[model samples]
Target: MKILITGANGQLGQEVSRLIPDASRPGRNEMDMADPGAVGRTLDEIQPDLIFNCAAMTDVDGCEKDRNSAYMINSVSPSVIAQYCIKTGARVVHFSTDYVFDGTRGMYTEEDAPDPVNYYGLSKILGDFAVIPLSNSLIIRTSGVFGEKMNFPLFVYTSLRDGKEINAIESSYSPVNAANLARASVEVERKGLSGILNIAGDRISRYEMALGIARFFGMDESLVRKGNKIPGGIARRPFDSSLDISRATKLLDWDFHSLESNISRLDVH
Candidate 1:
């Protein structure tokens, strides 16, 4: 397939790229999704038969600080990509988040209605809507993705390595392995699955995930402290954004790893 991966340098994007080594990978400077003109020109050039749109403005508080940029990248850009794919008969794999839910509950299924609590989630929810009707498209909602690219778990590992204390949030989530999610995405695409599907690791809290990272790396788990609130945070987090992957589990006949197994699988720098 003539494949294109947006945000190819990001955490999930890099993992996706590693799995699909020959896919076209444009840097942010090359195809900034925030700019419609750039996205248009890039799409025209690539004319990909498949698109893995891993790009997004993911910083929750940053999304709250700049709604325009958030909506542009998270919503408008995906709309543009979907429109392009619609005309060209290309299939797309759109990455989404568990943040679409309000977190009043846990293990949310695809049937669950999204009631986002923050601007970032709101923007991503809008993005999901834009791609919902696109034929042959797959929207995979994942959570707390960490990989070779710097992410939450890496932060904990480094903090403990430096002998600095870390405040691990108490929010519960399925901290997905980006490598696992990426590999599974390819299988899901090959299986011709459409619409929304959940792909994530076993559910656990930030504190628990922090300790798992420490255990994997043989670091001091005691350095990780638990807290419910982010100090001076801009956006409100969901209490439990863990996704229920029952559908994906049956479809792929593959379930993600447990926290311990997942961390063990990672090189986890």
Candidate 2:
């Protein structure tokens, strides 16, 4: 199958590229998602059978500071891609975040109404809505994704490696391994699934997740401090944005990797 992956530099995008080695992986230089014309032209040139869009303005505080860029990348760009795909008969698999929910409730089902608390969440929700009407398009809502790239777990590991004290938030989330998420994405496409689905690991708090990482890397857990209050940032984060993966688990017949297992699987230091 002719497949194209955008944001190939990102953790999830890199994992997807690894899984689909033959697929066309385009960097920002080749296909800048921020430019709608460039995205459309790229789609026209590749004419891929499937497209995986992993690009987004993911930095919450960054989004808060620059709402224009946030909406442009997170919402408008995907919508542009979706429109092009609809015209060309290409299927799309887009990645979204748990931030779409306000975190007032945990284990959010796909059917749950989204009430985003921050600009980042609002931007992603707009993206979700943008592509929902398109045929053969799927939006996977995940949380706390970690992989070889700089993420929560990797940050914790790096801080410990430097012998620096790290403060982890008490906020809870369902952390999905990027590799597992990539695998699930392919599975969902193969099964010809459409619409929204939640693909996430078991829910765990930030502190416990850090502790697990410490144990996995044989690091000093004492260096990891528990942060009771929300970390200072321009944006407000949801307290509990864990997603219920029952649908994905049953549909894909795959069990997502636990935090410890995910950590052990990583080859990076």
All candidates' lDDT scores?
A: 0.88, 0.87
lDDT of 2 at 38: 82
Pick out the ten consecutive residues of candidate 1 with the lowest summed lDDT. Answer: 260-269
Q: How well does candidate 1 score on lDDT at residue 187?
A: 90
Candidate 1 at residue 257, lDDT? 48
Q: TM-score, each model?
A: 0.93, 0.94
Instruction: Give the Å error, residue 111, model 1.
Output: 1.1
lDDT value for model 1: 0.88
CA displacement after TM-score superposition, residue 80 of candidate 2 (Å)? 1.1
- Distance from true position, residue 51, model 2, in Å? 0.5
lDDT of 1 by residue, 141-185 (tens): 999888776777777877888999999887889887788889888
Considering every candidate listed, which one attains the maximal lDDT?
A: 1
